[model samples]
Target: MARILALDYGVKRTGIAVTDEMQIIASGLATVATKELLIYLEGYFKSENVELVLIGEPRQMDNTASESEVYIQEFLKKFSEKFPQMQMKRVDERFTSKMAFQSMIDSGMSKKKRKDKALVDEISATIILQSYLYK
Candidate 1:
């Protein structure tokens, strides 16, 4: 079976996650610069069979679109244009960053390690994928 991929998009960097072939477990894959995301996805898609791409949709506490949504919207347009055959969906991403941070704390990660934004991004992506899987 083709895997399901998830992304936690940011202006500077993006986190990526993927499920197993059975689509049962979500795992953090990588953190890539925003500018390199398309290239990275292109290379990954060429090697792996990804049936769907889940992108984290940032929203404010009141459910309005977040400021970051502008960047995400732009990315989505280019993403669709670059990979028209790829299926994409958006998943609500409220509190994901906070959750990721708490997860790191609960996991006993070092303070220095916990401060790594890339690691947080990757964990956030995993959380996003897991949320989708559970849904």
Candidate 2:
């Protein structure tokens, strides 16, 4: 089976994660600059057989769209233009950043490491992919 890839997109950075070939386990792939995300993905896709790409959909407590939703939507448009052949979908990502931070705490990560915003984003992507696999 082909692997599944997920992204936790941000304005400054974007986190990436991918499932195993069997699609059983999700793991952090990398974090890249938001502006370079498509370029990075172009390279990764050349070497990997990704079945579908999952993008985190950030929403608010009231299920309303987040302030950054417009940016995400714009990115999505560019993503479609660049990878029209690639399958893609969106998964709810409410509280994923908080969840990722708590996960770092649970894992006993060093305070300094936990403070790494890029790492948090990567873990958030992993969580999104894992949640997709779970359901």
lDDT: which candidate is best? 1
RMSD of 2: 0.6
lDDT of 2 at 130: 92
Residue pairs that clash (backbone atoms under 3 angstroms), model 2? none
lDDT tens string, model 2, 1-135?
A: 999999999999999999999999999999999999999999989999998999999998999999999999999999999999999999999889999999999999999999999999999999999999999
TM-score per candidate: 0.99, 0.98
Candidate lDDT values, in order: 0.98, 0.96
Cα lDDT for residue 82, model 2? 92
TM-score of 1: 0.99
| Candidate 2 C-alpha error for residue 128, in Å | 0.4
